[model samples]
Target: MRQKIIAAAIAAAAVVAAPQALASEELNFDAYRQMLADGNPAELFEMEGEELWTTARGPKNATLEKCDLGLGANVVVGAAAQMPRYFADTDKVQDLESRLMHCMDALQGIPSAEIINGSFLKGERAKVAALVAYVVGQSKGKPIQVDLAHPKMKEMYAMGEKTFYYRTGAMDFACSSCHSQDGKRIRATSLPNITTSKGAAEGWGSWPAYRVSNSQFWTMQHRLWDCFRQQRTAEPVFGSDVTIALSTFMAGKGNGHEAVWPGVKR
Candidate 1:
């Protein structure tokens, strides 16, 4: 079925004339995505995440059912949509992955270093990816509601905004270089102007997605890490302040837009 869908999409794309190919290709890609929605591979990760959330593991042999994701403990619904918020317990603004790390340590006695130092889609980091998949799945179609009321959150946002436009690395490329404008494409992928709210939402909300090209699930942290790699900048530590700050900036800008989390990407 998936192959058939892909073939159909390819056939549709092949008929476009050279002058209109780019625009028509994008439309066909959207149609292909819609056709695959019911069978997204992310669902498998979501199931794994749900099991991880409920099962006892780590040193303490306790479950993360009580983990607070910016809402009250054990509240799975709509919680992710409001993340990257200030948590008084830590006295810092944290995104979903960082907060989950805190909960794993506090509630399950899992060391943060295990996840931070691990490779993507391997060992503990793989579990984190699955957990992220499950958590964000619940917030699908919910409005993005990241709050920047706290001083820490505001500071993070400022840092994120600076980071977005700050040019560095060998290529002297900032995130804004690729994403600040409309009608930009890197190969077949459309670059969203994340400086705008709609673009921010499209950029921020549709992450922690499953990449069809690689057949692997990626957390937002992984996404940012890759972005830095592409820009030839120093890769930030996993769940580091800079990554959270960037997340805060995008989430704040994306407020009120619907989340399309656990999204499937080409």
Candidate 2:
């Protein structure tokens, strides 16, 4: 018993000397992420998006400057800060990308089919990505301001709440599976817990960001769709109800968080 106690004492001293061996692994990329953010490539996309908003195209050939984004028509500033709101015209609660799609088709006379069901990060889809960067950039440093009062907005939020925890697909994975826990990681990527307001704000606000890992900017819709794919679930149709619902959920949770997009991420 004396020998065993001595060995235990030696083991304890060794562990004390190397606390890192027992410490939880925390792979922080803050420095590298900051370096990438300082010179975000999304700037280029935002420039392109500005041009798209002002230029005329499609069948009717009208500018999207007349678009109504839940504020007033032609109002670009700070509109993104309050999106995923109820739009009376469409009578639907739409996120930034979905609202943009509506305006492009209505004001620009672009066909809805042209924007929907296209492969991501290519051609028109790529153009849409740039536009997302520009519009969301308008709300930079402003707080997330999703409105929850309207009945429709509340309805969407409820649906979103349900969808967030609805687990399925081959992996039986849900957004909660990844985002409900803190300090969890898959490989080197730290997963933010969106169940909490702080985590949700950080995760939601730092999007429409330039992804260093893939050399592209990802809009909120693209991010959500990709999340589904990663979960081995069916590819969610872009701007579909489920997508919008999930966006509403995240955006609502992130309410009051300052928008800080064009984020740089690996």
Candidate 3:
């Protein structure tokens, strides 16, 4: 009976210690990332993206220096911080990737179909990824300030919230399954609980990032596509409304937090 009591005590102690252990591990991982931040390979992509922004290309032979990223023309500085906002020209709420595609089409004469239909990291889509890296790098320390004032933006945010909790597919997983709470992890990666403002900022502001595991820079749109694929649901088209809506929701939730764009991810 004494041995049984001791065993039970030991088990209880272990249960109590588990969360502390996980927290320590997460801190260690953050330190590791900080150590690697100085040499992050995302900088290469940023440089390439900057070049793409300034160089003339496509049928129009125009530089994207004139692209309107919710600021006036040719303004790249800090524009990404307020993105996923309403644009009157398109009569739509556009995220960074979609807005870049718009500029590529309207200003550079690269048809939107090329990006919508092309595979990621290939051809025109690849150019957009580089552009994303560049634009996001420009907004690294800026606050996420997505404006939800417009009726369309409010509508998109609502759709995104609905989509976030709607579960289907073979695994029966909604995004909320993995991201709605704290202390959840998949293998070594700690899942951010995006239901909270801080978590939403971490999840939303850190994307358009370089993934160390895949050796690829993934835009927010690409990340959402992968999320759908992982959920065993039909992946939406690139720049589809659902993707933009999700961006709006997360960005709106993350308003006032600092962006960590062009981030490096494991």
Among these predicted structures, which one has the highest lDDT?
Answer: 3
Q: In model 3, which runs have C-alpha deviations exceeding 4 angstroms? A: 1-28
Candidate that would win on TM-score: 1
Between candidates 1 and 3, which one is better according to TM-score? Answer: 1
The 0-to-1 C-alpha lDDT of every candidate, in the order given, reads 0.85, 0.80, 0.86
Q: Which regions of candidate 1 are displaced past 4 Å? A: 1-28
- The TM-score of candidate 3 is 0.89
Candidate 2's TM-score reads 0.88
After best superposition, candidate 1 residue 259: deviation in angstroms?
1.2
- Estimate the lDDT of model 2: 0.80
lDDT of 3 at 198: 94
Write down the worst ten-residue block by lDDT for model 1. Answer: 13-22
Candidate 1: lDDT over CA atoms? 0.85
My TM-score estimates for the predictions, one after another, are 0.89, 0.88, 0.89
lDDT of 1 by residue, 73-124 (tens): 9998998999889999999899999999899999999899998988887887
